[model samples]
Structure formats: C-alpha cells, structure tokens
Target: MFKWIQGGISAVTGLAEPEYGESHFHSSTKRLTSKKVNPYTRAVVSAGDFDFQNPSNTNVETATFYINDLETGYCGFAQIIHSNIGITTTAQFTFKLYNNNKDLGFKQIWTSTKLENFEIVDKKNFKADNLTLQWNEDGSLRIKSEVNPESIVDLLFKPSITNGVKFGTDPNTYYGPSIEEQWGSMRHVYHPRCQVEGTVTNLTTGDVIEMTNEKTFGLYVMALQNMKPHHCAKEWRFAWFVNETESLVLMQFETPKSYGNSIVSQAIVTIDDDNETKVIACPCENDLKLLGQYKDEETGWSFAKSVDYTFNGYEIKDNNVDNEVITDDSKAITFELKGELSELIERMDVMNEIPQFVKNIVSGVTATKPFIYQYFSKDLTLSRSDVPESAFRGSAWIEVTYITDEREISE
Candidate 1:
C-alpha cells in the first residue's frame, strides 16, 4: 500500500521510478539441475573471469582496497565510491587504518573523506578529490592520497599471485521486466588475494606504518548497486581469510522478501599446496549457517556469535574456461569455514555512520535496521576436504539487516 501510493505519486511528479517487476533477475534465476557436485547458482566463474566494470554507469558503485599487515596486526582500507541517489550524484572517498594492538591507536587518527571532483577514468584509474588509484596492466594498483593534511598515503598493491573473480556469466544481477527496462542492478569483482607494499604516514608524529609483500596481504573488492540499499537485499554475510598457504573468501547474497527471498552466493578458496597452487575452486554454490545467534535487545536485530560457510564447485586446476558448466566430479571440490569468528572489530550502524547525503538515500527504507559487524580472528580454522585443518589469521565482515516483513505483491 505504501509503495503503491509512492509509485502513484511518483508517476505524476517525475520522481524516481522505483523499478517494479521480478523478471529482470535471472542471474541466479535457476540453479542448473545437473551440477556435478551441488546445485550451482553462477554459470561459469573461472579464474581470470574477473573483469572491471564501469561504475560511472547509472549506478552507485564502490571500489575498495583493504590491507592486512601480518607483521604488526595492522589493517587499513581506502575506498572510492560513485554515489547516485535520488535526484543527485556525488563522488566520495574514505581512508581508515586499524590496529589490533590498542596502544598504537595513536597512528589511527589519520582518516580522510571527500565529496567532490571524483572521476572514473577507465577500468584502470579513478580519482576522488586529490586521491588517485590506478591499476597497471599486471593487476597492480598505485594509490596516492593527499586529500587530507592529517594523513599522507603512498601505497601500491601488487598481486603476488592471485585470481580475479566475479559471480556469473552475465555479471549484473538485474531487477525489472528486462535489461532494457530494469530499475535495479548489482555486481561485484574480487581479487580476494593480493599483497601490499606501501606506507601510511600520520603527520602528527611523522610516524609510518609500512606494509610489504613478504609480511602483508591485501584484498580488493569493487561493487555496484544502482537502487536504494534496502531494495537490494535483506541480509549479507562476508568473510575473508588468508593463512600462510591458503586464502578463503565468501560472500553470501540474499534477495529481499519482496523478491521471493532468494539466496545466491559465491566463494573462492585459493591454495598454494603441493598438488595445485591455483584457485582450487571459485564456487557459485554456497551455504551460510548462522550459529549462536542472539537478539540485540536495544535494536531488536539478531546478532550471531559465529557463522559458517560451505562451498562446492569444480576445482579449476587450470583447465576450466569461463563459458561452460563443468559436469564431471573428477575435479569437484568442497571447502568449509568452521572456527571461532575471532575478535569483534566494529559494529557499524549504517544510518549513524554514513554521511547526511548518503543517509537521505537510505532514509526511504523506513522499516529496515541495517548493521554491519566486522570481526578479525587469528585462530579460526579453514577446512578443506583435501587438506589438513589449518588455522589462519583473517577478517570477517558481516551485515544483518531487517527489511519489511514478508508481503505478497500482485503482478
């Protein structure tokens, strides 16, 4: 009733036309009935199937560079976003540095944000304010930020040996009657495994935090969402873990109830083991199990003490291509995320943490409570059917959202 009223009002005033239909979402429309091991959502997500999509399109997009220092337990991230809200568009950039050790929290003070002069030059370069992030032909990025006098950054992210990945063949998860008439879309690109060699200096003490290839690892994610945040999904769970010899990452996607409450997920496990050193499996089949969940009395949102992920896919020991489905179990594989969820890094309240303009975009979602929980643990274990259980220091970023209760919509 409320959305119908809004649509009727919008129809007359040239307001935002919220897309209305379910046919546009076929990216995960149906799982193949003949997967070798498990029901698969994405068609063929092979290593090197990852390609950079233009965020400058009619969508809200963000590119993030996250770093983890194995030597000093320090982590940092730099993000540039192309924000397209109702009746407006803007570019935003933010940089944050975190430390597991509480004492050196002094250096964490140098944070920066900007709201203008952003440009996405191509798949390789982007600029927001005075910050510039450019990617080389070899998947290396040069990041330089001088937008803030408080912090100075000169960082370079080079992929030592990593595979770039995305979910499906078509890539964009659309929502509407068709592509030409679609009103919403979402996509993601990942280099879940990488290395960082750079320094972030704080002007207060002239102190420097150095990250190198031998002692630090980094993960890169580029994502896009063209609709109001709440219209996309009801909940999301994410995990990224890298140990001495392996890196496991998972992203669980859940569509909103209005869209039939669909679940489609993607995950990858890259190993440098003896038999295979490549991405063992970039699976489109994922199961996220929420464990030890308790309700937050203050917010009424259920928070989980821990979560688990199970993935099944074909092991691309270098033979799988990007176009067809694998039908043989000869190289089928499975991976599991079973361990402590580590330290609670931060509990992010979306409405309170975001800027005012960004808030206006999400304000339309009146019934949703959006919170993100980030955890970092050094003791969680990664279990694979082929190898011994191994523990690794890694980070998990989770989001628990409550949209409107299930409501039937008439076509």
Candidate 2:
C-alpha cells in the first residue's frame, strides 16, 4: 500500500517521515514496490520466498556512472554524460575509487573498493599517482596506500559532497523535482566509483543470465547531481513513450523552472536487437495532451481524467547498418495514446492510518510524488517487457521536464 509518513525530520536519523505515517525506510522489506518506504533502505525484498540480494538485511546504497549518447560515434549529437554516488545511513563511509575509461569504450567505471588507509580525494581530482589497487578473494576491491585525506578528494564533503548523496524513488520524503530530473546525471558524475549489476532472464531460453559491471564516468551533469523530490515543478517531465518490434524506449526529461511548467522532453527507448537503440527526445510535444484531471476521496489519488498522447514511431534504416543500430534507414511514424485520467488513478487508495487533522493541512490526496522513472528503456523496458519472445532490463535516462498543473492536490 502507498503510505506517506507525517512528521518532522529526526535530527539523529537524517531521515524524516510525512505527517501521518511511518518512514518508508523503516518498513521496507523487498522489491521496488509502491509501498511507501525509504528509497535507499538496506532491506531485503522478496516475491514469494525468493530473496533479491543475498542477506537481504544488508543495506548498501547503489551509485553509478552513465553516458547516454544518441549519436553512435565521433560527432555525438546529444551527450548526457554524468556520474552519481550515494550511500545509505551506515557506519563508516569508506570506499576505493576506480577508473573505467577503457573497459566500456565510452568513459570510466569503478574498479573495486578494497583499499585500506587510502585518502579520500576531491571530486574530479584523483591522486592515483602513488596508490595501488588490488582485488580480494570475495571479488570485492581493495586498496593499499598511505592515504592523504587532504590530497584525495573528500567526495563525501566539501567540493565533492553531492557525490555521496542518495537519489532514488523514495516516497514520504520530498526530495523535490530536481532530484528526479537529475537522477541519472548525479549517479554517474559526482561519485568517482560506481557499478551497474543486474540479471537478464531470457524469456525464450528460460535461463537467467547474470551480469555485473563496475565502470566509472569522469564528466558530471549538474541536473543528475542536484536532484531531490519536492524541489520544484520544473523537474517533472515525460516523453512520447515509444514501443517497437525488437525493443521499446521511452524518453522523458524534466524542464528546469520556467513560465510554462510542463514535461518538455521525455520518451522511452526499446531495442529488440542488441545493436539497435532508439531515442525519443520530446514526447509531450509529440503526443501528450491534457484533457482533464481530478482527485477522489476513496483512493485520494490524483489522476489524468483524460490524456491525449502520441508516439513518433521507428523503423530500421539503411545508413544505421554500419553502426548496426537498425537494419534499415530509420523511419519516423506517429501514433496516439488517448485515455481518461481515471485510467491513471484506478490504483490509488486512501491511507487509513493518516489522520484527518493532518490531511487537512497537507491536501495532496493524489499526488504522483517524485518518481524519476521511465519504464521503456533497457533496465526498465527490459524488466517490464512481457513480450513472449523478449525479456526485460534497466538503464538510466536523463529526464528534464517543466510541470505546471494547478489541479495538483498538493498545490
């Protein structure tokens, strides 16, 4: 169930709850569900009895470096390059940083975090001139060096403090819209070390293929680094929401604060073939039209009472062969996605524990909250893809949008 905790911030916990419920991080169990909880809690999530991460109780904040280049090579058209690092509330925040420039043919990815007595460096400035990195038997990384805290970047503080901040779908906490807009950039830029690990279950083969990638990107995108929920409406965004035969990719981005607050650039990407990657830059301009929206008493969730959306289609292109992204020259097609606002709100429900007294003060009964999500990309489209011949995966895409909806319950 969706629960928004109501309370003031806890000085000791650095964690806060909404006004009428418990902190999501405290009640977290497993799986990224809509069940209100901390986005960075170290809780084990399970569906049925299958545990997701081993020792599910162990809490570890995940960070990563990502580079989304719509252009295949040299003359890159759109470059969304950045890094992000985050850690949950834990004992010691000690980690070894690694470089990943050659591993992925793109940028840097972290190597390992098995260093001892190593110095913490500033963001973008690493003193690898005298440090030695080693790998451990358990596959964890280790470092050996006479650490110079002052010389090495103190990414957790000062010049590089944003690197250590957590960014994810954390309900109950108002991280602001900027947090959601820059979710991708912050994860890959600020933090010097990061990894991308996941499992790809081939629906056709029924064999689960596992993959773990440790890579780092050097550049930083401010949009990704400084994001948090409740920051502003400028960060709320959307895309055309694309779908294809081999794959589907939806691209959506939040617009920085502006007079016309609306999702400017947002779309999903899908790929059936390995080399093929489709990018949709602006969805709202292509297929997003607001018919009406409203809130209800029972569910207390606001929904698009009516929405008119469109999709600029994709087809294989001839020139894309050398790049092997598509079989034929890319063909753009346009389609529509029109439906009622109720369709988006059918799943919302009121929180029974929320006191009526508090609800009166904060009136948002059907707010989408700060969920920086695009379910049509590799990581997302892959996981949520239910095609009989396809599986699912996840990937981070930059989202920049402008939100200007006065009908919001919270407003």
Candidate 3:
C-alpha cells in the first residue's frame, strides 16, 4: 500500500505538486551536471550499481537483458531485482526463454532470496548464488546459470553498437528527474543494442539449443524506482526495434491521476554504418493510438493487439541548450505494428510470478495488473518524415502495467 500523506491525494490530482524537501525538477535553463561517459564506459556503469541504502527504504533497482534471434525466432530474457523497503529486503532472479518453433511456447524460472546473497563485483560482474553474469574485458558478456535444472542457460552478449548512447537527464545522478521527492522516482538507462551467442540447455530433456551470432540482436536495460512499484506509475510501455544497421528504443510511462496524470518518455535512435553522419539520442513525448485490442475470456484482461505510435518533442543536444528542436511537424517520426490478435505472444502474467505473500500484500493495497507481450513481424515498419521507410523485420517486447483504479480487468 502507498503511504499517502494527509493531503497528498489532492496534490497528486494537480491541485499542487507534492512537496518533499528541496525540488530536483530542473527548470528549462538548468541542465544536468553529470559528465557523459564514453561508449565503452557506458556499458559498465549502465549496469546500475547505484546506492540502494536509502534510509527511507523506498529504493528498488533492476537489471535486465533482452536477447532475440531473427533467424531462429527465439527470444530470451533475464532479470535481477533488488528491493529494500523499511526493515525488509528482497532479492530475486528470473529467466524466461521463448521459442515459438518448439512445441512448448516458453519456459520460466524464478527464485527469491536475501539481498546479502547477491554480489556486485565492480560494474562488470554481478553474481546471485548459482547465476553469474560477467562482462568480459573485450566487451562481450559471459553468463552461466545453474539456478534451475529444468532450464540451464550459458550465453554471451556481444554489443553491436560501439558508440551506445546513455539516455537520462544526468549520468551522475538518478537516470531521470527526481520524481520521488514529489511522487516516486522512476529512471532508466539503455544499451541501445547488442548481439547474442552461446546455448541454452534443457537439462530435463537433455536438449541443447545453440544460440549463434547469426542474425541475433539484443538490448540491455537498467531501471530504478525509488518507491513501491504500485505507487510510481499507472501504466508503462517499452519497445525496442532493431535491424542490422539501425536500432530504436523507446520507453514511456504515465503517472497516476494523483500525480496530475503526467506522462514521461524517452527515446534513443542509433545507426551504425559508414554512411551515417550523426547519432540521434532525443527526449521525446509519446502518444499511443490503439488500433486493436484483445480481451482474454478466461483472465478477463484486455491487451493491445495492434497499435500506431509517435514520438515528437525537443532533443537535448548539449548542456548549453536544453531543448532543441530536432523534428518539427513535417519531420515527425512514427511507427506502426500491424498483426493479427492470434499472432501476439503472451509472455507472462507478472502477478503470478511473485510470491503469494507479496501478491496478497499488493492486492490488499491497490489494484494492479501486469502483463508482458512479444511480437515478431515482418510487417512492423518505421518511418520518419525526414528519411525513407525502414522496414524492420524483428521482434519487440512490450510490458503493460495497470495500477489502482486504472486497472483494465475486463470481467
């Protein structure tokens, strides 16, 4: 349950901004003070080794790795979570391997333990019990996990983007604005793109699936939420689209009505080749227009089947200028995902993944529904008014979260 002040609800509803000591929201003239890191250094620190020992016990941090194989149509995801609230602390690791070609749609493995069991060996290495993630000196990642016998994974992540862009307001401070002082702080950093290799062995069936470097691309993300997850955002949508030469990553989330129903978003566009002139890392506002939606009869839940979205706003080029006009009305960028309802890959029911006690606690406090979806389509396309159409034939991951009275449970 959220710890709302006596009049916090009114403040959240646009009456006034919630107060929490000094304000961290920068004015239009004040720019971020953190120094920009080089591409190689970006990969290491972007792993998120920030301070979590907040005396308020509201800090939560997560590191996620997303892998996709274009040729084999296999997608893999691994997440490590560390949260400390008051006197209690929780640490967890989760893995999901999705293979559409296989008879079984996907496999999930998860475990929860104390925070002491997790170790961060510098910015390049992270260990949680039997699972070890090591970023090699050469920039490749060596991952080995023996947490679950049913699904054993050994893989390597080789970054494809040499000059990856770090998306945030300040590189030294939290990823974005300090919304926590008002409502809760939600921040993120993205490693635009990477390539994946190695293998995932199903110990149960004695089967070994080789994950090669052939047409395999990936993305890395680190996120921090400084309050209870339910109190932070009312909804979230994240998408990553990649091809051989270019990659586009977008993240958007909306605050609860109590927080004045505000929306925050960011985007990173990276193009790798000899012909490209400059990389575009912009902060943009996103609008989602739902073209189609599907409601599951059994779960009484609705999800977007197809949607058209656009990201339009100013771009931050340098410290001297905070908001620079990169794309005007005629130069808007838009993306469209067209696919049948039956084609949508239902990744998981996040509520069912957590421990029952925690689930009950959340359910008792607020209304929350979380679902993950993945889509691989040759029809997904991207077009910027300034450039030619770029046909993207790959996979995309989507997470839909609804909180409080905004819950979209159909039944």
Candidate 4:
C-alpha cells in the first residue's frame, strides 16, 4: 500500500553538505522489495562500504542508516537508531566524526532528508520495493528472513553541527597572500585499533547478545599546523579498514604540501607458546591494485578499491580473501594484503578553490610508493580461545609501524 500526494515528497532528498562544528550528522531512507523480508529490528545497516554496526540495536523490524562524526583533535564516532514492530513508526539516525585537538577542534554535519515532515508514496506508481545496497566488497547482502511484510515511507533528515563552528587546531584563521607558497607537513601515522560494544536483539528469538570486538588497521596522513593569515593550512587524504573477527586494520594517508607521501601497515595476533603478543610490520615498498568502486546514494560519499590483500596461509577466491585453514582445517592463520592507491590530489586541489597559501603546502608533491604488508598466525587462535568469555566486552587497542622515505617499516 502506497500513496503519493501532489506535493509528493521523496524517500531520500540528497547528500547532505559538510559544515563546520563540533560534530556532524547524516541520514536517509530505503525500502525492501522482498515480502519475506529480513526484519530491521534484528539487522543494523550503514551507509558507505564500511559496515560497522552499533551493538545496541542488533535485530530490527525496520531500520534506517544513521551517521555521526565527532570533532576533537583526532576524531570519535557514534551511531544512533530506532525501530518499529507493527504500526508506521519513525526513528532518527545520527553519527559524529571529530578531532580532540584542544586549540583546533573541528566538526561537520550532513543530512539527506528531514524528519517531523511527511513524504508521499503512491502504491500504483511506486515501481521498486527492493532496496539495493552497494558496496566495494563484492558480496550479495540481500534481505533474507521469514516473517512479516514491510515497506518504507518517506525518509528524511538534516545535518547540523553541535557547538557551532571552531577552527581546527589553528587560532590565527586566514590564508596568506600567495597561492603557491610551501607550507609544512604534520605527521601522526599510527595503526588504528578499535573495540566495539552493544547489544543485538533477535526479533524472532527475542534474545539479546552483547557484542564487543576489536579490529586494527594502519593509517597515513599529511597534516598542517599554525598559519599567520591562513587559518586552515593542513590537508590530508588516507585509506584504512578494520576486520574484528580476525584482528586486522590498515590505512594510508598524506597531507597536502608534504615533502613525500607516506604508507603504513600493521597487524596483531595471539602468540603461540606462552601466547603473548606478535606484530607484523609493513613492507618498505609494495604495489596497490584497484579492484572495485561504489558510492552512497544518500551521502554521496565514494569509495574505491585502493589495494589487494593476500595472506600466506590464507586463500583468495573469486576476488574474496579469507582464512583458508581456520575455516576448513585446523591449520595456522596467515594473511597478506595487496591493493592500489587512486590519485586524489588533483581532485583535492580544486576543493573550494583552495587558497594559494594552502596550495603552497602541497607544491610539487607526487604519490609514487605503494605499501604492502602481511600477517601470519602463530598461537593467535589458541590465545583468543583461552580468553574467558567475560573478557570479550568490546574494549580493544591497536598499534602500527609507520614507514616512508624517512623511517624503516618495522614493529
């Protein structure tokens, strides 16, 4: 059943714009086509290819994608949600990305649609019921369930900053006179590790499971600090991903106006004998391969395959990489990552017609090096198994070895 009014509204408005503040928020609506649909109450959904589900709402009857970006010197994130059982209900989606820097904290907000307002959907003209979610990872994640029939109304929300606008770490906010002046670079390269905690409620079974898992990855960035005339001088572009069930995370980033770009990779696994901690460092030099790409309809944020991952003890099949022995046999867990880096500097240069002083920072810099890294299983599996179930509460830490033209890549 659907209806569309003359001033008929749409389910999703458009991608929200990023604004300055302490935090940013974004949201959008989608509908499922299948009748025997998977209940949103049990399943959590997210925009972007990165599927990090909040532990709080596990099983959902109906769900929406919410994102929040908190601004500190670094950044923190939170995902908020709501669900429905029978009647037409509404929920708000929110998330934040922030930097914790005391002097230059920054944030932004982006919302695709608005709430407190109704949109129209006429059954007769409504063409598609199936909501197709796109991802850089090649896998069919369809709605598979055995329960009631459901549909989506108008999905809308707004993105606004929390604490107004603030300069990012720099106090004297303004750009210099020249567009081609050379600015300095800021480096804070490290491996990112995370521990997540939440509760998942099974719609059919009516059971709740608390989830707390840790994932680690590498990170790269080029940063800028303190400007006389120009307030925001630093620009950074990077990539990273987190795999919890398997303890892995990686990233590569460089700020605009840097001497040379940088890449890093790292991993942590359970040790064997006494089962302590073992780390694998990033390779001095490597190559990246781009396998796929996609974009979110609501936020318009895009992601591209930047590298290929391969593990020594693991296997890659149909473009899918996974633990070979752990899944089939009781063999050692080993892994490797391979991938490519897309040239984003040219595109970034045009961002808001960047001021000359800002442009000076990234002058003559070129991205040439590709990063390669590997991880092998020792007693990691055995050690994780030994941890009491009580210790799996989702609080985790990550470490990374950084290497570039300047430093050796080692743990």
What are the models' TM-scores? 0.82, 0.30, 0.75, 0.26
TM-score of 1: 0.82
- The prediction achieving the highest TM-score against the true structure is 1
How many clashing pairs does model 1 include? 0
Q: Model 3, range 85-140, lDDT digits (tens) per residue?
A: 64666777667666645555454333333334776676546787788878676766
Q: What overall lDDT goes with each candidate model?
A: 0.63, 0.26, 0.55, 0.22
- In candidate 1, what residue range of length 10 has the lowest lDDT sum? 38-47
C-alpha RMSD for every candidate: 4.6, 18.5, 6.4, 22.9
RMSD of 1: 4.6
Residue 118 local lDDT, model 3: 70
lDDT of 2 at 225: 25
lDDT of 2 by residue, 1-411 (tens): 233232232111112223321111111111122332222211111111101111112122222222222112110001111211133222112222211123434321111223333222332222233453322233222222223332122111111111221112231121223433322121111211122233322233343323232221121111222322222232443322222222222333332222123232223333324533222211112444545545534433334444444544333232112112222444444534443322120131122233665434333432322322221122223222123534332222222232222346331
Writing each residue's lDDT as its tens digit, candidate 4 over 1-411 gives 122321121112111111222111100000111221111111111221123211121112112221111111122222222222123433332222222233552322212221332221221011112322222122212111111111121211111101111011111111222223422111121212222233323344443322332221111111112211111212222223322223333322321122122222222221112332222222212233435656524323334434344322221121111121123433333343333332221111121333554343222121111122211111111112223431111111111111122221111
* Segments in model 1 whose C-alpha atoms lie over 4 Å from true places: 1-4, 8-24, 28-58, 102-112, 161-163, 273-277, 353-365, 388-411
**Residue 84, model 2: Cα distance from true site in angstroms:** 12
Cα deviation of 205, candidate 3, in Å: 1.7
**How would you encode candidate 1's per-residue C-alpha lDDT over 99-174 as one tens digit per residue?**
7676666435436466567766754577766688887767687788877756677888776454465554445677
Error of 1 at 248 (Å): 1.4
